[model samples]
Target: MTPAARHAAAIGILDRWLAGEAAEKALTNWARTNRYAGSGDRAAIRDIVFQSIRCRRSFAHLSGAETGRGLILGALRAAQTDPATVFTGDRFAPAPLTDAEFATETALPPAPSGNVALDCPDWLRPLLDRALGDQALAVLEALRHRAPVFLRVNSLRATVDQAVAALQAEGIDTRPAPLSPRALEVTGNARRVQTSAAFAAGLVELQDAASQAVVDLLPLTAGARVLDLCAGGGGKSLAMAARMSLQIFAHDIDAGRLSDLPARAGRAGAPLHLLDDAEGPERMAPFDLVLADAPCSGSGSWRRAPEAKWRLTAERLTQLCAIQDSILTRAAALVAPGGVLAYATCSLLEDENSDRIAAFLDRHPDWRCDLSRQFTPLDGADGFFAAILRRVD
Candidate 1:
């Protein structure tokens, strides 16, 4: 498909998404109905749609409207490209820009100030400001772009150099990420990773560098028993399994989420067990380390799931904080005396990170938080927060 046609397709999909359809679901529905769009076309269109979502506010300001047409036209203008080129009114292309849209003033980049410039929701701005303080603006600005793809080299299977070489042989170039010794930031052919021999062989797994860094901070002892309390898809569970000779058990509230973990663990050749029953963790209690990678606003990884940024509400955030609190409590109960209860989230909000830890400490007077870290887009990966709380009693 021509670039113009792809933009037109993206505009349609974005409209569906803005109208409350989930982005991925909308993309999938579009692909199923529009079989004429090839794989490359679908991918290109998805990128455009996601990019528009990431900078929705800024683009809306530039185009003088918040509709899909406005967003695509504004994206073109932001990149210093004339909207007329893509909106040619040709067959399969977007309709020609109207007089209002073609105005020179609106064609300029969005104002470099306020929520529009930051692309942050107004309701959440004060929370981020209070949490991030002086660096709030810079971090918010950093989030208005794509996130880098990072792979965790499965040290259980291959060395960093070996993994890089294997991936390079399959046309996927990677360089070691500074965030973690086991992390490799994919430089090229990121899409081919799943099909590559290295991935199938479990030499590496797609994970964020900061996520890997969170695992890097784990004080894993040889032969220690670890439980990923909220092992959704088992990314953290696999990372922990590869870290050392640990007995890794994966569990999630929704067992459906752990369905893929067995195959993944097998491929990685890691000894990862699944506690399918809700009572399973309690039965296998007193683990040396328990990681509760609880659900949250997902603000840190918004670039990958931009629609979520606009969809999150303050009430929902409060609900997530309460859930995080519950997760910490449950995970703490399974930790061995003197064991580590690692609470983590892919959220930058203090309410979900530091505040949760504080609340946990307040609730459990015997537990003490010894280490904590928060990573933002400024850190070159998705924002993540990990706190190590030791069960002292």
Candidate 2:
């Protein structure tokens, strides 16, 4: 498809998204209906739609409207492109700009200010400010763009150097990420990573560098008994297995998330025991390490899931915090005497990170936090928070 047609397609998808359809679902529905569109066309349209969502408020202010057309116009203006080229009223392109639309463009309003300019929700600004402080704007600005792709080298299958060589042979270039020794930041042809020999050979897995860094910090010993309390997809469980000889048991409230773990673990040569919610905690009790990778607002990952940023509400955040609290409380029980209880979240909010840890420490006077870290976009990885607490008595 032509570039103009892609933009037009993106506008339609955006309209569907604005009308309460999910971004992914709207894009999927469009793709299914428009079977003539090629992979490249679909990817381009998806990018345009996500980018517009990432800066929805600023784009709306710039285009003097909040419609799909306005967002596309604003996107073109932001890119310093001539919107007339795309909105040519051609057969496949968007309709020509009206007199009012042209006037709005000519008399573009002054730039947005504060939260709007930063592409943050007004209600979320204070929370982000409190969490990020001086780095708030930088982090928020980072979310307005695409996130970097990172892969974790599975040491069980191949060394970092071997994995790099294998990936390079497949035309996918990667460089070491400072955040974690086992991480490789894909530098080129990242789209081909899944098909690369390195990935097929189980030498690498798609995981955020910061997420790997969280596992790197864990104090694991050979043959350590570990429990991943909220092991969604078992990413951390795999990472831990790669690092050392671990009797790893993975569990999630929703057992369906762990359905693929057997295949993934087999591919990576990592052995993981799956557990059901009814008896997993009791059977796996007294573990040396228990990781609670709890759910949150996903604020740190807004760049990849931009729609989540706009959809999150104060009520939802409050509910998530409550859930995090409950998970921490329950997971603490499964930790053996002197064992470590790790709390983690993919969020930059203090309420979900540091504050939650503080609350946990208060409730469990015998357990003390030993280490805590927060990873942000500034760290060149998705934002993450992890804290290790140890039982004293």
Instruction: Output the number of the lDDT-best candidate.
Output: 2
Q: What TM-score quantifies how close candidate 1 is to the native fold? A: 0.96
lDDT of 1 at 339: 89
> Across residues 42-61, which tens digit of lDDT does each residue of candidate 1 receive?
88998899999999998888
lDDT of 2 by residue, 1-393 (tens): 999999999999999999999999999999999999998898889999999999999888888879898999988888879889999999889999999988876887787888888889999999999999999989999999999999999999999999999999889999999999999999999889987777877999999999999999898989989999999999999999999999999999899999989998999999999999667777769899999999999999999999999999999999999999999998999988778899999999999999999988899898898999999999999999999999876
Local lDDT at 38 for model 2: 91
**lDDT for each candidate structure:** 0.90, 0.92
Worst lDDT run of 10 residues, candidate 1, spans: 104-113
TM-scores of all models? 0.96, 0.98
TM-score leader: 2
